[model samples]
Target chain A: MIDVVETTLTWRRLSPRMLVIHPFQEVVRAAPALLGLLVAGSSSGGQGHLWSVAGVALMVVLGMLRWFTTTYRITPEHVQVRRGLLTRKVVTVPRDRVRTVDVTSHVLHRVLGLARVEVGTGTSERRHEGRLKLDALTAAEAARLRVELLHRSPAAPATASTVSPTASPTVSPLAPPAGSTPAAETELARMRPEWVRFGPFTMSGLVTVGVVAGFVSRLVSEGNVDLGRVGPVQETWRWFSAMSLPLEIATVVLVLVVFVSVASTLGYVLAFGNFRLTRHAEGTLHVTRGLLTTRAITIEERRLRGVEVSEPLLLRAVRGARLSAVTTGLRAAQGSQRGGSLLLPPAPRAAAVSVARLVLPSVAGASSAWEASPVTADLTAHGPAALRRRFTRAYGVHALVLAALLALWWWAGLPSWTWLTAAALLPLTALLAADRYRSLGHALTSGYLVTRWGSLARRRVALECDGVIGWNIERSFFQRRARLATLTATTAAGKQGYQVRDVDLTEALRLAAAGTPGLLDPFLVEAQHVS
Target chain B: MDTPTLRSPQHRVSRTAVWYWAARAALGWLVLLAAQVAWLVADSDGSALPVTAHVAGLVVTAVVAVAHVTVMPQWRYRVHRWEATSAAVFTQSGWFKQEWRIAPVSRIQTVDSERGPLEQIFRLANVTVTTASAAGPIKVSGLDRDTAQRLVAELTATAQATAGDAT
Candidate 1:
């Protein structure tokens, strides 16, 4: 156990090594600019060198000054961080409000045995004022600070109620502060090398390959390398020019497949290498992963509301799924589809579910509302009108595209085969539309509202009803014509809007009314006779 | 099925809301017109566009400005409805695509009343109710100044009272 000073009031500076580390980080950040200067100087004769030197010097001074001035203190009531010379700002987060203590160590920091710690105050707004970050600290000290900040007494009435009562049996022996014993820690999941097989199944492989190839080509071009002179390029180009059209296309595709597979395998290794999830006695789930720059994310057990299992179309073919925690206080990027809630990388369906159960016990336990196996979960399908709408909308969009393509073919003489291709894709679109309708289902389990939707990348989330704070009902004129409405149950956890789409308006009203009983009663028109 | 009535029917905003929206639309048109005038003047001095092209552009702009100044305010007035109870605030807005939002008092983080220069001249105010939900704040515009102030006060009081442990 690392020795920890228990003083609460005194302000503290991070390890002095931070001064060196911060300046080093600044230099590393300035490397690209320095490289650009070098390139320019070589091209234009020495003017850029002076600017590069000045920029590096200024960054070093600023980094040193920042390190020297910044100080933080964990008082009994709040965690206060005071810094900035010219701006001079103070950020204070109440102790109870601190939700997550994320520790990350870059390759450099790891070599120096230091980690960066960020204390989040649980506010989802991207305001720096609500967060406290310590740029560098010993790995042990980071662990201890995480434990100290997250440690809540089991006897505390407020938090105890949130934790499963059965967990109390294991609580007594684990009461000592973290870093005290390894015996109470339980390893929940670890990365399996075989899971890399699912990496290519995700569309990310092709995207990653394309990105890397583009970047490499750009770099090569900048360095005055003739791409056509490259061995594979020259050979392929010569062969392609000589070959039949179909064979040429096949060869190109084969090369792409090979590149994508290799990139996917590499990406999986970089992301999930040595991935480990463990539950501390203090009820914080620590997830550590990554090969190059290891990241350690701490999630308080109580803040967890539920779990989501997503299976993309390609991944689903092989029974692979990814798990994400639907919890409060987790950072969600503005307008982005994915949040910082990934619990398990794409893996075998069984493995993902097993890990989800371990991380979130309530998801599968006897007292659970949702099923242990989401596959077996009896979800209620929406009305047939919803299916009709999906098909009509899907086909309508495809028809519009086809019409535009036809018009282009008539006006500008586009390839007639392109029209044939578009025509052939209609069946696939119809199949997808049918699958989307089949995927749309919602259920009010004992304590959770489980909604499943999407065709390309389907997500089935079982969000705890208790976590719901509000209910929104929307009916567009088109939806009204179909007597349908979208009901979104707004919860602090997970995506802000989780919709039970294209349900009968009355059904939506009833669901909203039932989710939060008295809250919506005032707004809902009662039936003439109480059923 | 028989048409169902909303148990707590929403209240339409003040009629002055039309004037407020019309003024805002006019202001937007004014800015666009200023830019177009500047562009037309610059084009005339040097690379003058065809007479027909300029006439067509001006005609489209005028038609759009007229439609916006006349039709939009009415549509907005018809679509926008809000209801506040002790438990939640329900706001329904948008014309072409209606949006319905509900924010529970328990999740209320802040309540603010804003009055722009145009709104001030029209004696109208907008009350914004912010929640932790990422859908962003709910703006109930076109309230009488006194009503906006009172609603803000009432919402603040309710928020304080019902503020339990929430993110």
Candidate 2:
């Protein structure tokens, strides 16, 4: 017979510290009534203290109710949590299915010695939506729970002599024997890293953001301007006259440069504040960092889906790359509605490869294969054919549209220069169309499908053929006439649809058949017979 | 390989499908005509309506409605039964253009039921079956409350049984 503990545990057992959201979040919640009181008091010119006092009292009461209403429970078999004051929610998750547990502490939570733990179970159901705010567990407690939850096996002995002295009987019913090798401890020891940091935040980046924010806010609040109004126009004209034309152009360029620099710098800082990544001896990747809010994420090697390495054009010069792992379940920290993309950005290509190998043993040699024959052939031939087709297609409609518009303007007695402007648009459109065409390419082998595309920013996505869950080939009436087909490949990470438009029918079929071995023939027949 | 074990047969949908088809047909034609008129108005010059564009839009809309009327319900009523020894689920919707899905008893990640105002009036509930993969979340609607409850219970039982076998 099993005895259930009916008493609810306090949030302290989950984590001893308070939440680390923006200080202004609490203030914002309390502000409306306080502001209303102040406005009313100021209008009346005196005697507002009572109203202010009442407002503060109401805020305090609401805050306490909010805190007390949210509670979480952990059991030997499962974890149960209940929250929300009005529309009550009860979430129950079995320990066996829980895949990943992430703990995060914002600056406030860090100060209060509290943290929020998020648990993600790899299930598509609504009830299996990742749990947020499993709050206030100590680092050690959170780690222990995470390890036990992730590694729990029904086949393990029901009773063993090797149970840890510190293990809670309620949480761990059938502990492993003392002398037996502990898999969890070994994994923990292997994956933890030492330190992580962002690129230096230059001073100029901050000023640019402030300026841009100010400019945008001003534009939004002011609405449309009246050029007829002499006062505002005169002020603008005065400022315009103060700067030289060259200086004005230079300033605009400088502002744009500063804007991008600042944004990227800030992104780096926010993402990697005091970051410490460690590989636990047990083969788990343990990442802990944050200046204001500390976060720890553990990625088990077995659960890793794939490794993605990306290199932007700018980064290619320095051989800088970003690495991210695709894994089962959500890995977002607590109090964060959005999840990180498992990225390690701006590292050397070698470092990226090393990280990929460490996390995904299967993908170890996959990066080297990136430079192999098929990839090179696919990349070089992909763009030129696409560009040729784009030029041909655009010439039929886009050039005609421009010519007609120019003719209309010329007949309307507009300046001949306007016709020149219209004619110029044709060449520009053709150039853009060609560039777009040149960026598309695809290659497929038995094990993988590699797609490379992009004009300004290049992207190469490599997907394992066996991992492809769904595929489709679509052809419109126009595409049928043109002998082209579009193929879409869907994996666990949303849908990636690629078009091999304007390819010979035979080639298209062959390519489709190669990427999705059993699916293409039926899909092609269905598509061809659709009309 | 040995023959796969098959689960029990799924309950069929009640025969209120004709009304559903009529409702869909009316909405589809109305929306199609409205969209055609909107496009014509937006693209028209300030002068008289472009005769070619106007006629083309009307013809396209009519053709689309004709296609929808033929395709909609045939696909909706076509039902299929999918069952494996450890998992069982039923998929029914349309004949030609259909939604064919299967969830094994062991693969069921979550079970949920919802009832709208119309469903409440008709005492019908829709049950959604979720799986480990995010792509497919099967929704079987127009089931009576008793039927929906029984289906849920059956699925839960099979899921538990399969889980037990695996362990």
**Global lDDT scores for all candidate models:** 0.75, 0.53
For candidate 2, lDDT tens digit of each residue in B1-167? 22111121355565454345545575779887988788778867725567686878799878878777766655454452322223345453444423334434555666788877666755677788765546555678767788778777777767666553110
RMSD of 1: 5.5
- Interface RMSD of every predicted model, in angstroms: 3.5, 11.6
Give the candidate number with the greatest lDDT: 1
lDDT of 1 by residue, B56-122 (tens): 7887998999998999899989878888888788888877566677778888988999999999899
True contacts kept of 2: 0.03
| CAPRI accuracy category, model 1 | acceptable
Best by DockQ: 1
Clashing pairs in 1: A525-B7
Mind giving the per-residue lDDT tens digits that candidate 1 earns over A387-490?
99999999999999899899999998999988889999999998999999999998776556778999999988877777777777777778877878888887
